[model samples]
Target: MAASSDAACPADPPAIDLRGLTKRFGRTTAVEDLSLTVGRGEVFGFLGPNGAGKSTTIRILLGLVRASAGSATLFGDDVRDVRRAHRHVAYVPADVSLWPSLTGAEILRLLERTGSAVDHEYRGLLVERFALDLDRAAKTYSTGNRQKVALIAAFATRAPLLILDEPTSGLDPLMDREFRRCVIEARDRGQTVFLSSHLLDEVEALCDRVAILRSGRLVEVARIAELRRLRRTEVEVSFTGQPPDLTRTPGVLETQDLGDSRLRFTLSGAAAPALRTLASSEIQTIEVRVPTLEEIFLEYYGGQDR
Candidate 1:
């Protein structure tokens, strides 16, 4: 009898799930009480600064390392059951390595053969788009070229889930944009992406939701927009005349004078009062800047040991 696709695995499980996951190495703890879920077909970002345990958590999820405490599942299958769970997932490490004797083309072919299915046509297009010189030997490829090979291989797999750890680290700005486009296309094809990175702009542009890690703990998890809403806005104004006083404004936090009629201030919550105060001045130019992910991360866990 032919095997049934749904016999062992159900369709409704989340793409990724963790509960109180922790890992300790002797006297040090790498990850602590971390928990989050990535929905099917969702682009979820796992973000943290260096030594914050982002890579440790990803290793546990990939079954490359065992968690000292708690549980992690991929598509409702325990990560410990590597053969079963990992068959549905594809991974791209931050630092990619290949056989010295193999050409980029050979490396790609080898990786594709290891997967259950390969989208050869798409893979070819990606190779061209990335400007990868696949004819060259793997030993001859530059950092960016090696990265391109890994990215193309991972993206070409017809796996239901993609686990990318700092996948764009070696790419130039143009390649980075191309990588984002490929991620969106994967999402459109109903594949889930778990992207781990310290690059705030990448997460801001691609992820639907984000989980931020700090000193081995899960600190915050929310939609990107919701997280942004919690941050204070930085506003700067240059006046034709003297700037109006904003110290009395309800939402204003800190104020500074940039000299020559320019004022800079941070506003939390509503901006109505701040706007009213700005209107009272003869404004020459104004600029409002939203908080970046790094700023938000610092706000939560800055000036502390990791």
Candidate 2:
């Protein structure tokens, strides 16, 4: 009998589920009390700074490394017993290595042997889509090209779940954009993608939800829309006359003169009061901009464990 689609998706379980997952390297605790849930077909961003345990968490989920405590499930099976479940999942690590003696085609063939069934036509399409030079030996490929090979092989599997850790680390801007497009297409095709990166802009652009980790602990998990809403806005104003006093404004955080009657400032908590202040000023030009994810990270991670 043929295997059912549920077998491919493993009971239609959440793509990733963890509870109090922890990992230790000798005396160093790499992950601590981390828990997260990623829904099927959702692009979930796992974010943190270096040594914050993001990679360790992904490794634990893949069963590449055992957890020191707690439990994790991928596709409804225990993380430690995911040999079958792994067939439904694909992983792209930050640092991808390919054998110098093999060609791109050879590497992909090996991957398919360990992964799900492959379609030659689909593989060709992936090669073209990723602009890979398959005829070249692995030793000839640059870092960015090697990353492309990894991405192509993983995505070509068309698995139900993808665990990508810094998958675009070596790509240029254009390739990065292309990679994101591919991920978007996969999500539309009902594939779940768990993306781990320190790049907040990437997270903001591709993720439906994000989980922030700090010093091996799960700090926050929120919808991307909600996190964007939580972000503060920046308002800059130029007055025809002296800049108005903003210290008394309810939402205003700080104001600095930008010379020639212009003032730049940041605001949080509420926007209404800031708008009112701007309206009352002898304003020549007023600009209000939302904080980028990087700016928000600096604010949130300052003096903290992230």
lDDT of each: 0.90, 0.84
What TM-score fits each model? 0.87, 0.86
Clashes (candidate 1): 0
Tens digits of per-residue lDDT, candidate 2, 1-306, equal 887766655356677889888888999999988778889999999888998898888888887899999988877878788786687788899999999989998899898899966657767887887788999999999999999989988887778899999999889998898889889988998989999988789889999988888788877798876665687677788888657878899878778888978899988777788788777778888888887767766666797543
TM-score (C-alpha) between model 1 and the true structure: 0.87
- At residue 112, give the lDDT of candidate 1: 76
Candidate 2 clashing pairs, residues 3+ apart or interchain: none
The C-alpha stretches of model 1 lying farther than 4 A from their native spots are 1-11, 239-248, 257-261, 276-284
lDDT of 1: 0.90
